[model samples]
Target: MAASYELKASARDRVGKGAARTLRREGLLPAVIYGDKKPALPITIPLKETTITLHKGGFLTHIGVIDVDGKKHQVIAKDFQLHPVRDDIIHVDFLRVSKGATLTIEIPVHFLNEEDCPGIKKGGVLNIVRHTVEMTVPADNIPESLEIDLAKAQPGDSLHISAVNLPEGCQPTITDRDFTIATIAAPAGMKETDEDETEEEAEGEAE
Candidate 1:
């Protein structure tokens, strides 16, 4: 499930690069809350607190409540800008989420039972194709990560999106086909030996 947090911000009366810089000088981060058919609200949140939340992980997917001058708004971080040199979060754009709204976000993938996986047990390498899958999920019900079980995975077997059991309303953005997420790949030498064995078997049969 998606986690939630709160942020305290002061309503900003100014907008533009100069105003943003001024806020930064005052140890605050400039931010805006828009979307959901409402006018954009400019605000400034404490730099220290916002930075802590940003580093906590899953900032984009987690729901946040921003209190602007005591007026609270439920929002999700849609975008954030970083300083090219300093690498600090300079600005943030949050989108207001209404009830029953579905959002397109990336959910991280987590692998399980690698030790017991038939492929890994045979020294097969687990090659990850996609680290995160873009999914269309409900705003109120976001999953932290999508898990893949490798207990039965065999060497050279491909794990596809069809293998995951998504949440009730969660759906992958790619609808065309069952995409490959990971693979249990055979080592180069193992593949070569297997090919040679197959060829020798074929030659003996022909004799």
Candidate 2:
């Protein structure tokens, strides 16, 4: 089951850059909630609670219950603005969701079976091309991470995005048939090639 977080929000009467900055100074983060046939509502949330919830992996993809003035609303973190220098969250955006709605989100990729991988045993290096992929899935069935097992992969072998085993009701947003997620390469041979190139360059300069 997907993880859930409960948050508290308050209606905001002030909007714009100055108001947002003022709220942040008071240890609050400005935010907005929209969707599900409702108009966008501006709100402010406690910075401490927002930071704690966001620290959880995949928190943005999980369902959130925002308590506003004693009323609860189901929403998901849709966007966030962060401080440029410190990278602290400055603002947030939430999207209201229904029970059966399908939402698209980017999920982290987890590489598994590395210890038993044939390529690594043969002194090959695994190159990860993508760390995440976008998927459209039922809100209730969002996966925390997509696992790709590389036990049987040999040097020069690659796993494409299509090869990933997704859970039921979850599908990748990318339709490209040849999108590679990871590849195993001959590390020793690549090093030898680099050495050879350096030697050739020296010889050319000597001539």
Candidate 3:
């Protein structure tokens, strides 16, 4: 699970391109909090603090308690706009989420025990098909990443999404079929050698 955070923001009295530009000039970023069957609220936050949070990473995946004019809203950063040349966050959109709401997010996949895997130890290459898996999870129980154990994985073994152990209340969005996540394949040199041996065998049979 990701750690929670609190962001301080001031309610915006005016909302428009002009007002947003003025706030940016004053070193503030314009933001909006909407959803949960409530009216959208326009707000502004400190540019410095927002920049630091963005640099820390996982702002979109983690839930944050946003304080706007003494009122708190549990939300997640859904979308953000950045200045093309300056690479600054100009505007952001926050989606209010209830505790029991189910949300879809792409969680990163972390492979473990690669050193102990017989395939990897025997010069096999690990080919990753999906670096991240999209899943539907409760708002408050989002996982940081999914771990896949490769302790017994061997060469020519393909790992599918069904092999992963997900946390309770977390389900993959892709439920139609068991998609492959990774594979332990033979190295290019090994593949070439096998092809050469097959060709030699075929020539010997033909002769």
Candidate 4:
């Protein structure tokens, strides 16, 4: 699960493009918290702190408590606007997390035991179909990343979502069918060699 964090912010009375620009000049970024049947609260946080946290990865999935004056809001980052040139976060939107709320997020995928894979040891290429899987999970038990074991994977094997063992209370949003995750494909040269061999065998029979 992604780690939780606390950010200090001051409620901002002013809004609009001009007001946001002014806050940027003052080394603060404008952000808002909305949802869960509550009013949206606009606030400004230190630019340095926000930038550092965002670069740490999984910022959107990570829940945070934003302290505005004496009030704190438990929220998850929903969206953020970045400066086209500078890549600076100009504005951010956070959604309030109500009790028993489930979140939809794209969790990263990783492969384990690659060296032990029979396919990879035979010079087969690992072709990844999905680097991440979208899932709706309970906020309390969000998984960091999904791992697939390739220990017994053979060439031309298609690893599907059904192969992944998900955590309790976590479900993949894609439920219509068993989706493919990755495949161990035969090498390009090997494929060509097989084709050539097949042609040669056909010619031998014709002779």
Candidate 5:
């Protein structure tokens, strides 16, 4: 499930370049939460707080409880803009969600057992084809990340989405085919001995 974070915000009466610029000058970030059949709620969050959360990776996929005027809104960051030159957030858009609503979100993939992977032990390189997978899941059951086990992977092995274990009620959005998630290939500049060893390893695995 996605972890939730709390953010304090205040209602904003105006929305425009002028108002946004003024808010930034005052150390606030202009934002909006809209969805679930409700009117868009224009708000502003403290620049410092926003910056801190932005630094904590995966803020976009994580659920957020935005408190505005003591009212809480369950949201997920849908979009955001960063300053072209400055290291700051300029604007953000959020989508309100109900606990039971299903949503499509891209969740990161975390590979495990690399040290024990047969391919890595034989000097193979891990090539990540998809760092994240888009999945449709219950809003309240979003997994933090999809785990891919590489314990049995060998060189020339291509890991596909079909090999992953998704959480209950979660499935990949791309259903046309079982897409490749990653691959273990022979490293660049392989020597003759390495090539022979890799082939022999593969032959052994086949048996």
Candidate 6:
């Protein structure tokens, strides 16, 4: 099941830089909802609610039920404007979504059972290259994350995007067959140094 977040908003009568600054000052964030053949609606949501929702893992891809002026709309966070200095959200943009629509989103990847992996036990370092991958899946079947178990991975073993088990109706957007997600590498010292030099040479030649 997909995770859902409830957000309450109210229509904003004023529109301008000054109005937006005022809203932020009053503990509200300005936002606009548009998509699915609906006109864009300007509104304001509580700062606390926005902060909490954004803090959730994979919040941008999570389906949100936004209540504005007593009407509920299903939407996905499309974009946001943040204050450069304060690093706070100053504005938000939400894209309305329908139940039958397929949404493309990036889902976080989690590695499990690392300690039990034979590679780690043999002084191998786990190198994770991709932390997230883009996927196109049903809105209702979106997964919060992708889990990979490395318990039996050996020193020379590698995990690719193709090896990831996705949820029903979910498909990785990447079609490359040889793309690696995680790999086991030799630990610090001579072996590691030699491996790094080899990798650097390979990279230099490729470039």
Considering every candidate listed, which one attains the maximal TM-score?
Answer: 1
Cα lDDT computed for each candidate against the true fold: 0.92, 0.88, 0.89, 0.89, 0.89, 0.86
TM-score of 2: 0.86
lDDT of 4 by residue, 61-138 (tens): 788888889787888898999999999999889888866889988889999999899999988989999999999988
Best by lDDT: 1
- Between candidates 3 and 4, the one scoring higher on lDDT is 4
**Better candidate by TM-score, 3 or 6:** 3
- TM-score to true structure, per model: 0.92, 0.86, 0.84, 0.86, 0.86, 0.83
Q: Write the per-residue lDDT of candidate 2 for residues 119-190, one digit (tens) a residue.
A: 999889899999988889898888888999998998888889867888899988877576889899878876
Q: Which pairs of residues collide in model 5?
A: none
Model 5 residue runs over 4 Å out of place are 1-3, 188-207
Q: Once superposed on the true structure, which residue ranges of model 6 sit more than 4 Å away at CA?
A: 1-3, 188-207
Which pairs, if any, clash in model 1? none
Model 3 agreement with the true structure over 27-85: per-residue lDDT tens digits? 98899999999999999998889888988888878998889989988888888899999
lDDT of 6 by residue, 1-207 (tens): 243888999999899999998998899999999988889999899988898788765568888888998998889997888899988888889988897889888888899998898899988889998898888989887787889899888776789876778799998887766578899886666477778999999999999
Assess candidate 4 and give its lDDT.
Answer: 0.89
Q: Which tens-of-lDDT digit does each residue in 8-110 have in candidate 5?
A: 9999999899999999999999999999989999999988887888789777788888999999899999888998998579988989998688888889999
lDDT score for residue 52 of model 2: 90
- Count of backbone clashes, every candidate in sequence: 0, 0, 0, 0, 0, 0
lDDT tens digits, residue span 6-75, model 1: 9999988999999889889999999999999999999999998989999999998899999998988999
